[model samples]
Target: MIRKLTKDDQELLMALLRKEPALNLFIIGDVENFGFEQDFMDLWGEIDPADGRIKAVLLRFYRSYLPYADGPFDVEGFAEIIRKDNDIHMISGASEVVKAFDGEINFKQVKQLFFAELKEMNNKISESFSSAEPIKKATVQDVEAICALTDTIEEFESSRNGSRTSLRKTLESNTGRTYYIEREDKVIVTASTSAENSMSAMIVGVATHQAFREQSLASRVMAQLCADLLHEGKSLCLFYDNPHAGVIYKRLGFQDIGSWTIVNM
Candidate 1:
């Protein structure tokens, strides 16, 4: 059976989500930050008749839908819920699970990326992997500079989708943070996290200036960011489709857990 979830279901909902915390970082963060009653967010669950326990979870945050299950689930039933909501512009989650919704959801594009998580740092990676200059954690004042730097990286050019307002809001809300390296007063290398909660965070917007590419600048920034987050006892996760980028993350102690798919409607 499928039903809308309320705060009363928090215990059940969190139990399922925490099973793979890194993979569900976004959903966990949203629930932690906005909760179930928000107009912009809603949650639903599929319960098993035999156990009366949640077997699948679906989340709607603004225009996006995220779905997850430990094993087989009623994909068609969840897809039905998504289809009835015209406000939904995208559906994203573990690729294997999300692909089942393709025919049910009207989407115009699909993005597939390898999902990875970092639980511990590799002993081989020395702290010296970071830049000689300390990486700076960004503040509201760095929004414009970060956006400018974002615009230069092909990988993240469309990642933020040109939303400076959103970027600014993220900074102000403390839901996210950016760690960067600057050269000659210009922001050059950056690695940021979004959808941060107490247990996990998703790494996004990793970019380095074109001139700084071969110098391991991106790795430096990412290493520092991941190290700090891990030190705080928060696991980190990221999405990457580029093989070269995958190599860098592997060296930083991230391993592929699954494939993440984002379908745009």
Candidate 2:
């Protein structure tokens, strides 16, 4: 049976989420900080009637759906939920699970991404970055400039706790790491990590301006970011749909763990 999650279920949720924290990073972080009452969350779970325990977890929020199922789940039931909601912008999950649901519905586009992770550099990577300027961790003062790079600020602000204000709050947190390259007070290249903890982190938001594309700026920032994370004993992970991006990451020592599929409906 699928039902809504309540605050009282936190301990149970954490146990399952911690089992694969990297894939469930965003879900874990959000629920840890806030409970089920957050505006962006439409959290649900599939409970096993036989065992009286949750077998699968689903989060529907921020125009996307993320599902994690280690045991049996109601795939058709969950797909029906997506079928009813007109707001689903993307569906992301373990490749097999996402593909199973994708086959049940028609989406405008589907992206099969490589979910890669790195615990150590395969070889010597330059500790030095030859950029136009030094790349460093972003502070709260640089939040606006960073937000300017993404064209989806309005949607982000509408998505509860994903606003520019939320970005500021994340930067305020010690675990939230956003790095970038700035030129004349404007950010041209950037990389960021979300759902950070002592054990692992999810690396996202790696971008570079069109004009700065060939300068290896993204690599510089990413290498620095991954190096920093691995140095602190955190396994860094990312999802990439672009082969070119994958090539860059492979050179930097990331190995393909599996695929993360995203379907847009």
lDDT tens digits by residue: candidate 2, 27-105: 7777766679878787888888887677788897778888888866799988888788877788888887787775677
Question: What overall lDDT, based on C-alpha atoms, would model 2 receive against the true structure?
Answer: 0.79
Where is model 2 poorest over a 10-residue stretch in terms of lDDT?
A: 151-160
Let me know the TM-score candidate 2 reaches against the reference structure: 0.76
How many clashes would you count in candidate 1?
A: 0
**TM-score: model 1 vs. ground truth:** 0.93
Residues 60-134, model 1: lDDT tens digits: 988888999999999889988888886778889999889887677777998898999999987567565643877
Off by over 4 Å in 2: 49-53, 84-87, 127-134, 144-175, 182-188, 195-199, 208-217, 231-233
- Per candidate, the number of residue pairs that clash is 0, 0
Best by lDDT: 1
